[model samples]
Target: MKITKLQPTVVAVPYRSEEVWAFGRRRGQISVLLEVSTDEGLVGIAEAAAYPSVDIVLAVLDSIEPLVLGADPFEIERLIRRIDLVGTWHHVRATNPAIAAVEMACWDIVGKACGQPLVNLFGGRFRDEVECFYYVARADPDEVAAEGRRAAEHGFRTCYLKVGAGDPRTDLDRLAALRDGAGEHIGIRVDANEAWAPGTAVQLIKEMQRYGLELVEQPTSGRNLAELAYVRSRVDTPILANESSWTRYDQLSVIRAGAADVLSVDNQMDGGLLNLKRSAGLCEAAGLPVVKHSLGELGVALAAAVHVIASTPNFRYANQAYGANLADDVTLGYGGGIESYSDGCVAVPTEPGIGVQLDADRVERYAELYRAEGAAFAFHDDQPRGEQAPALPKR
Candidate 1:
C-alpha cells in the first residue's frame, strides 16, 4: 500500500523530578508523535525525541514529506536510503530522530500488514521481556539515596544516575549515599555525559569504585577515543561509550580504538530501529555487549525499541528507559512510570505492529501542554548556574 499522509503532534510529558545532567536540566520529555497513514487505511505510529530541538525535528519531517509520501511502507531500507541520499540527510546527524520516526512507523505498518509483531519480524523473541534501569535524577545526597532505595524496593536491577555535573566531592558523597541506600545488590550505573577529562575520569572512577560501580558512562569527551582508552585502562570500572558510539560508523571507530568495555546505541541517534538491530549485531561480533540508550522517549518510541531488544541477543545489560522519571504518558498504558514496569522489565507486546495505541484524550492533553509551555520542557536549565557555561573536565 502507498503512504497517504503524515500527522505530527508535539507533546510534553512532565517528569516526576527534574532531569539533571552535565550540561543542563529538563523538567519533562518533549517528543514529536508521528502517525503515518497509508492509502489502504492502515495507520502506523511512532515517536521522535525532540533532540537538539523540536523545531529541528518538525523541519525534518516537513522536508521529508515529499520523499516519504507515496512510498511503500514495506520498503524501509530503500525509503531510508532515499531520505539519506536523495534528501541529503546522510551527513546530518541531527536529522536522525525525525528520519527514525518515519522508519519506525513504516515498520509498524509492515508488522500490521503481515499480522505479526515487530519482534517476530525482526527475528522472533530472543527474549520475552526487556530489562530497563531506574533513572535517579541527580540531586542532593539524601534525595539520591532516597531514589536509590526506591529503585531497589521496586525490584529494579540497576539504578542509573548522572554524574560530572558538580564537584568531585559532591558526586562522591552522592555515590556513597546511593550505595548505602540501594544496598549491595542493586547495580549502580553512572553517566558523566562527556564531562570529564582523562586524568579526572581515571581518578574519579577509582574513587567511585569504592561504592562498586556497574559501569561508568562517557566519563571523558567522546571526540577522543584515545582519552577514553586511557581512562578505561586506568580505572577498574568498565567504561560505557555514549557520545562516542552515536552511529554505527562511530561505534566501529570506538571498537578499533579499544576505547570502551560497553557501547551505547540509540535508534533515534543513528536513524532507525533496523540500524539499532544492526548496531547490536556489529557489537555482538566484536564480542562487546550493547546497551540501548535514550534521548528521553515516550511509550511509542520506548515500545518500538523494546520489540527490537526482545528479538536481539547480546543486550546483556539492562537498557536505558525513562519509566522511573516520566510522570505520565500519552499512550494507553504501555510505558510510562515505574508502575508500568514489573521488576524493571517490560514485556514485549504480542499485538500486531508496535502493539500500543495512543490514548486520544491524554495525547490531546499533552499536546496542549506542549503548545502552552513546551519551551520549559526543553533540554535547558533555567537555574542561574545553568546560564554560566561549564568548563569541561571541571577539575
Candidate 2:
C-alpha cells in the first residue's frame, strides 16, 4: 500500500525524580513519535531517539512526509536510503530522529499484513518470554546496596547500577555491598557512561573481578575507540559499546578494533529496523553479543526491542528497556515485574508487530497538541540535498 501521510508527535513527560547517569542529570523526558497511514487503511506507529531535539524530529517528519506520500509503505529500506542519499551532513543527525519511528511502524504494518508478530517474521520464537533484570537508576553505594536487596527479593536475576561518578572508592564500596547483598543469586552490572579513564577502569575491573560481575558498559571515554580497546585488553570485565549509536559502521569499528565484547542495540540511533538488523547480523557473526538499549521509550519502542532481542540468538545481555515497568504511568502496558524481576529474562511477544498497541486516547490527546504546535516552532540546522522541506514556509 502507498503511504498516505506521515505525522510526527512530540510529548514531554516530567520525571518523577532526577536521574543521574554518567552524563549529568535529566529531569524530564521527551520522545519523537511518528504515525504513518497507508492507503489501504493501515496505520503504523514508531518512536525515534529524539530526547535531545524533539522539534528536529517534527521537522524530519515534515520533510520526509512528502517523500513517502505517494510511495509504497512496504519499501521501508529504499525510502531510508533515499533520505540518506538526499540528506545533508546534519540531515543524518537531524532526519534520523524520525527514521526509527517510520521504520518500526512499517514493520508493524508488515507484521499485521502477515498475521504474525514481528519476531516470528524474523525467525520465529526461541524462548517464550525473555527474562528480565532491574537496576536502581542513580543509587550511591549504600543506596544501591539497599536497592540491590530489593531487586533480589523482587526476583530479578541481575541488578545493574550506575557507576563512573564521584570517587572510585565510593563506587567500590557501593559495588562491594551490592555484591554482598546479591550474594550468588543476582548478577551485578555496572554502567560507567564513559565516565572512567583507562587506568581507573582497569584498576576497578581488577578489583570487581572477584564478584562474578556480568559486564561493564562504557568504562572509559567512548569518544576514542582506541582507548576502549586499550582498556579492554587490560581488564577482565567484558565491555559494551553503548555510545555506538550512530550506525552499523560505528559499531563495526568498535568490534574490529576489539574495543567491545557486546553491542548495545539502539534502533533510533541507527535510524530504524534496517540498521538494527545490520548491526545485529554483524554482532552475531563476529562472535560478539548484542544488548538492547532504551531511550526512555514509552510502549512502542520497548515492544519493538523485545521482539528484536527475542529473535536474535547472539544476545549476551538482557534488555535495558525493561526499565519501562518503572517509568510511572508513562504507559499502559505494565505487568512486567515489580516484585519478581523479568523472570530474569525477556521473552518474545506473540502479538503482531511490536504487540503493544498505543492507547488511542493518549494518542488522540497527544496528536491534538501536535497539530497546534508542530515541530517547526523552533529551527535547527537541516540536512543537505533536497533531504528536508522548507521551514514551515515562514509561518
What is the C-alpha local distance difference test score of each model?
0.92, 0.68
lDDT tens per residue, model 1, 122-206: 9999999999999999999999999999999999999998998567888888889899889999999999988888888888898
List ranges where model 2 is wrong by over 4 Å: 13-17, 89-95, 322-325, 329-341, 362-395
TM-score each candidate.
0.98, 0.84
Best by TM-score: 1
List model 2 lDDT by residue over 193-276, tens digit each: 777767788888898778887988888766788888998898877888887434677777887788888878778777776667
Pairs of residues at least 3 apart in sequence or in different chains that clash in candidate 1: none
Q: How many backbone clashes does candidate 2 have?
A: 14
